[model samples]
Target: MKLLSLLVAVALGERTLRPRGRNWVLGVGEQGPAARPPARLPAPTLSAPAVSAFADPAGALLAGLRRLLRGDPTPRCEMSRFVPLPAPASWARSLSPEASCPRALDGEWLMVSVSGRDLSLSSLLRKPAELQPEPVLITMATAVLTVLTHTPAPRIRLGQDAVLDLSFAYAPPTPEPAASLAPGPPPFGLEWRRQHLGKGHLLLAATPGLHGQVPAAQEGAVAFATWDDEPWGPWTGNGTFWLPAVRPFQEGTYLATVHLPYLQGQVALQLTVHKPPDVSLTPAPLVWATPGEAPPELLCLVSHFYPPEGLEVEWELQGGPEDGFQKATGEKWLSALHHHSDGSVSLSAHFRAAPVTTKHHGARYACRVRHQSLPTSGRRASVTVEVAGLSGPSLEDGVGLFLSAFLLLGLIRVLSGLVTDCDPQEKVTASTPPTF
Candidate 1:
């Protein structure tokens, strides 16, 4: 009975102490339950002192931690587990020699020490711990450090092995595309009038229906391909072109094109070379005069299809062989001068002295007309002036003769002894006779 009771008690105790169904009980020699993994603790928050100590190597690590934290959706405690501490050497090098040790205690304050100098937890912990490693934090911290380090601040200690490793988040800058040239609306349907200037230049003037906006720059070289032309411009503000001289040997109409860079368009112009016209000058007959006779009235008439605005008329007397002659002026003369409106300029003047004696009679007088527009063209006329007998003398001529005679007599008296001379008187003989 006693044995039965004891056996029953042992069985009951085993059942009570063992785990529920499917549980395996290990004897003393059997292996124990697999060791439970060590409970993970949250990463320690670096105190101001520790942060200063680790600054040299910890900056990169802190930045990484910040990145990881920013990416993590978890709360602070969970995030700390994912962000592990950086390599000790990298952290140590980042820290200054005087900021070598830092500690966090009671989750409220950070104690810092450098070169045996103590810095209070409150003083170093002015900024929130979460702000560390952020861009703004580093900027602010550097500024604060600059101000603080100048004063009697704690010193940091660093070993030769310490190094700071930093990697910046950077991206290449994007490039912008160049601006396109903009040309405004072109004129509607209209035939353009083309006028030829010197060389390869053709002036395209706007006709009745044609209109054009002036280009920004006026001068430039044009480039044209068979199919298309584009103006690659460093255009000038003056719309002028200087081109090589064209040859007239070719018989066909030459097709030419120009690319206006500023206007961003191609222009077509045509040139036709032809022979020049025959040009000649012929003068009309002239009236004749004599010495002491009335001056011959001179008139010249020129005929041409186109007369330029800047025409100048000039006359020269035809003396034998000698080219010297006086330029005729509009001053008053012995005879009235007249220039008729029929394109003929005339002059009438009395000849005080005959230009040609009977010996050089029928000499030619030439008149020339010049202008700017007609460079290769001019008008010339010639007339003959002959000496003939004079008409009756006038009162003016008689008075002139009387004055001439009076002057001649006065000159003879002053220059010669004929008028002032007296006969030599005989010497008085009274003194000589008394002596005798």
Candidate 2:
């Protein structure tokens, strides 16, 4: 194996190693009625599975032909050519993983010509009923490719370290005597850009082996670091880049462009940093509003979350005194909001008003907050309804009543005693004043 690898590498003139489709549709192709495979004993068969992975039915149909054909098969059909065609300009960043990007894609046509026996079209079946396969799957072809899914691409995630792999399907362009990015000629470059990020001193010379260094910092043959794109940094014609420690500022559209010695195109991915809400829940245990006058309210506070999308607040009712919570409906009040001086915003959802019946003795109304950050059940807080039944007044009310009665009785007694003492003694008061 090592000898074989070495020989292959030497044949390709590689100092060391080399290496590495969705919207995925498949179509089957059949030859015209006039076309037919010549019965010259047997011929080499093409492997249909090798050309496309999704052509499973074509693979099964070709397998039967391979078994019947005894001896070395002569090659009949060959894969002409396939190229990675870029999406139309109007599609823009259509391939971006962001949900906002339109998923509708313009179709690309694939022309297939098969040389094999053609069966007469079934006249009984209508045009709509006739079979129409996708992506040109060939069943009776003599030569075909044993198709398999290609090497997996990079898994992009925000705030996580991952390899930004830019591998070529074909053997890369011939290695020059010049320096490479790594042991082999793998591309090593990292660039981040957005207007809000402001400017940094990041620079990359057009020459190879620059590796994210400022143009001024590099040595001989810097070539003055000329490029049209202003935000470029640390990139050359390498096959891969080690993207490390993704930060919040890096959240935005990330476009990976390739300008090889002979080719140029771009692909993009989206990165959005999600700030999970602080989710402070304040459950008011008492009735949320004045009894018999206003609607009862169950309030939920969702605070400090990023990308302030709309959230859902649900109120659940306890089925019975001892029963678990179930879905309860109420007229939704407007959401309450809280804002911080630092510019953080939070919203509160209130479940108030709307009554079906007032028999809510010890019934619990739970307020559940559903946001992009929370789980399926969401962040919840519950409050039990203390139905205003035959209970006495509160302690403060009872004490106030006692104090008012005592003060009133004392004032009445003092006024009556003064009035009773002054009336009959008025006649004796005049003679006593003259003697004095």
Clash count, one per candidate = 27, 30
Candidate 1, position 425, lDDT? 37
**What global local distance difference test value does model 2 have?**
0.36
lDDT of each residue in 217-307, candidate 1, tens digit only? 2122221112111232111111122222322221122222111111111112233322221222222354455544444545444333122
| TM-score of every model versus the real structure | 0.23, 0.41
What is the alpha-carbon lDDT for the whole of candidate 1?
Answer: 0.26
Tens-digit lDDT string for candidate 2 (179-237): 43233432322222222354432212233344333233211111221222212211122
| Residue range with the least summed lDDT across 10 consecutive positions in model 2 | 1-10
Which runs of model 2 end up more than 4 angstroms from their true locations?
A: 1-208, 211-252, 258-260, 263-267, 280-285, 288-298, 319-330, 336-345, 354-359, 388-436
Q: Which stretches of candidate 1 lie over 4 Å from their true place?
A: 1-263, 266-283, 304-307, 320-360, 374-377, 389-436
Native-structure RMSD, model 1: 41.7
Candidate with the greatest lDDT versus the true structure: 2
Q: Residue 4, candidate 1: how far off, in angstroms?
A: 99
